[model samples]
Target chain A: MNAFPPVPEMVAAVRSKRVAPDHFVTESLRRLEQHGGTLGAVLSLTKERAQADLAPLSARLAGGEDLPLAGVPIAIKDNICVRGTTTTCGSRILESYRPPYDATAVERLVRAGAVIVAKTNLDEFAMGSSTENSAFFPAKNPWDLARVPGGSSGGSASVVAAALVPAALGSETGGSVRQPAAFTGIAGLKPTYGRVSRYGLVAFGSSLDQIGTFARTAADAALIHAVIAGRDPRDATSSDHPVEPNQARSMDLKGLRVGIPKEGHDSAIDARIRARLSATQERLLAAGAVIRELSLPHAKYAIPTYYIVATAEASSNLARHDGMHCGVAAPPEKDLLHQYLRNRAQGFGAEVTRRILLGTFCLSSGYYDAYYERAMRVRSLLARDYRAAFEQVDVLLGPTTPTPAFKHGEKTSDPLQMYLADVLTAGANLAGVPALSIRAGHLTEGGSELPIGLQLTGPAWSENLLFRVGAAIESYWPEADRLPPFVRSQA
Target chain B: MIDENLVRSVAHLARIAIPEARVPGLAKELAHIVEYVDQLAALDVQGVAPLTHTNAGANVYREDEVAPSLPVEAVMALAPARSGNFYRVPKVIGDA
Candidate 1:
């Protein structure tokens, strides 16, 4: 029997007594164990905790309590804390650290009746664009095993693409969520900064990080987004603005003004992606939406600005893991300085160390004004560009990534090449806007088809509008039956 | 170019050790990244105020009333090494 069902179908089946919660949990675990080794998508499975958490839910369902996500098994990126479970963040530093409290997002999801099935892998500290940076193992794309599922949320994206679970939660600092979702041919949403509470989300870039959802469709993403996106007292930066939570509501695109940034069509974008983008625009135009060309003059600076700002924040944030408090500790030494150095050197992987050093260099006293301050100013300019574009158009459209997933070890040797993969997706994070990556179409490469994502970024707190546009696009180009051949054969 | 000496100094500042053998490779990579980021210098950001926070809210504070905190034992449980009610660490002050 097919164990993987989308969120809505799974919920309906369980609610109507067609399927039991225990059966869903068991089947999900079995499938995860069977396929997880090949994909390397899951870091640790919380089968015992999931079963324990589901027992009371079964009784509650029998009591006729209305639970929107009753019995739905969901995976979370390892970076997000889950109490009493190993939250590795795909780094050796945190190999044994089990958080004492659940992240606000995890707490809310559990309360909404979702079963936490497993913790997925990620780039160490959510720093890399590919899961190759994961301390343990890199997650491979389900469509083509040789290619990568994008990172730092590669594990979450891979599992969802393989239909291991209907949906998973991934965090985005830059393009960690959207890029992976695109590479894996799924839908992912990076909520506006501060839309989701950052409490207990091991910070990579404090200003840019936000928890996002990966699902098979836009509506499914919206369902999970509603449950997780909200303000919390624990997160001081979280927005206190009222949330409408109408993301799942579908709407027509009539009279909508969609802005196409001229910079989005630059030479770096793949021909297939450009063609798919054109097809999407044609579809939008047919749906009674007006497409207009706009400009973001400072767009080229996004990658550089992101690296500086993100790494600088990362350097400061990662300083807490000095072995005395939490995480892996090195053998004791007589001197305190040696202890810190030894523990950190032994704990962090190469990519993480590189970022920490880069960040430290940027924030150092002499270089602060030149690197950190300049990047921040450029970031402001990028935000200004977005605000200006929004005045003319209701939403901005672009490619999620310049190209599709590359082969393993393709860009690992060159750090800048890997960083370029996130170029198109970073602007949304820098602008603090809500962005969604929908599988617009597919591209054939090396005798296999890879997915292409079209990104839609809206003004702050405009997830509802983005989701509507996404749902409409999904309808025009339905991907409901486009499961990878591997998954299809299994079914 | 960022030399090996600069890379070592930065790693020291970050409290991450760079073994002597890897210093040259690390410096080369750091130099490449720094060069890539240096493109920002071409932008005209004169008089543009830096955006430190995405949201407008600042100085968010709750009332000074006491609130329940995580139990000391629970907090200490995650610590790598701890004595009763205290986290144990390497000695900082050395004998003269």
Candidate 2:
């Protein structure tokens, strides 16, 4: 039995009556149970809920209806609300909270005939680079059990990498989705901001947050992206642009202009990872694509600008989480103010508290002009840089993360170091353009091989182009379909 | 540099309590992060307008029609303290 069939294959199998939807879901649940413990990829499994949810899809199939994603089991990141299921942002504040309504993306997935089998783990409130900030246990990378799965979408990426699920939904604020995907050697896409509705997604940064997908293949990611990309009235920030469905076109790299930004090749990047990126460029050139060196002069300001803008928005968004309205509440205190303070302090993890404080400081009265406003101005400069670069080239390519996945506690002690993990990927988010991370090659270190990702970023509303380029690049990797060692052993 | 007092003030503004002992360490970390982000000061953003949202659409208004809202009971159920369809909170005004 194939453990990780791409989305189209699963659809074709279901259509041909080769596999029953019920049976497929059961097998997926069994595998999730088998591997979830070691990987810590799943926080909660909704076996009964998934069976109930699949009844209608099974009936539709029996009734001769062709569903785009018939019987495909997908996992949801804990931050995205799944109605009637626990939506804990990997934080204790909302430990027992159940959202009353499904996020638009989740609702659309259900309509597309996808069954959500599990709610995966993540960093506390999706705040950290490594999943270590999870109030629960950190998710371990499938490639190396001792190392972390890059986060805050760590569990979403880990499950897909481990073949526990064919695809999963994760929300990206900065590099939450792509970084983890790079670490796990999966395809993850952060669609252009406003491409996907954010109505039910727990907000990290209102302007920067976007719902994304994770899958083994770029084609599968594109399929999922198409289902959830349309505008929704419920989200005022959602664009009214029409969704462009992924046309399963052949991989044609001819005539595509690829740009390599000098700023992307930072000194901090691992030498081996840099070499892998160079090799990818060579492959693209050989495929008849034009490669040129480009410069994003203001790209260096991405990290600082992203942190300031994201945190400022976060402070405002998170202000609603006081214990009075919902979530975990502290026992009644002497007054409302004390109650809020105690409840928040006890409920939020250390990293979450730190971010809240930082955000508060940035938006403080005296510091607002010097910090928040200045960061916004610099953010404009960074976006302008991308706009200018895109005019000269179709897309920009670079290593997804500065280095491969690191050990669990390697950078947790230093918060700034942790922030730098998103340095390479944050530019795409800051520019509000679509970007994808595809497995490029592997780095061998100390007898173990770790996967690396090549990120392709394009202009706004250019998801289709990004996917086309990603699919072309994905075809060149000979061992692209090989499962992680742990997954191979289990299979 | 961010000091313990600044950290305390920020935490107070955010309405999250920080332990007195943890303030020193939190202050140190916050200072480090601030120092790193301070690099933005070197950039020349003289006349650039802040880009708050990526798109140019503003005032995305919809018809003022009544729509189905979450039932009061459901909304009340999520609250920590509620009394007969109203969320109950501690009194803000004290007796004069």
Superposed Cα deviation of residue A451, candidate 1 (Å): 0.7
TM-score of each prediction: 0.98, 0.98
Across A1-491, the per-residue lDDT of candidate 2 in tens digits comes to: 25567789888887777888766677789889989889998999978669778878767887887578888899999999988888889988888788888999999988888898999999998998889999989999999998888999999999999999999999899999999999989999999999999989999999999999999988899999998898899999899887776764446788889999986676778988888788888999998999989999888788888888888898888888876777744567777788888888888999888888988999999999889999989888889999999999999999899989999899988988899899988888888999999988577776767888989999989989888889888887867667888988875
Cα displacement (Å) at residue A448, model 2? 1.6
Q: Which candidate is the best by DockQ?
A: 1
Candidate 1's chain A scores what TM-score?
0.98
Candidate 2 CAPRI grade = medium
Q: lDDT tens digits, residues A166-248, model 1? A: 89999999999999999988999999999999998999999999999999888889888988888899999998778885558
Listed models, DockQ each: 0.83, 0.78
Segments in model 2 whose C-alpha atoms lie over 4 Å from true places: A63-66
Model 1, docking class: high
Candidate 2 Cα deviation (angstroms), residue B17: 0.8
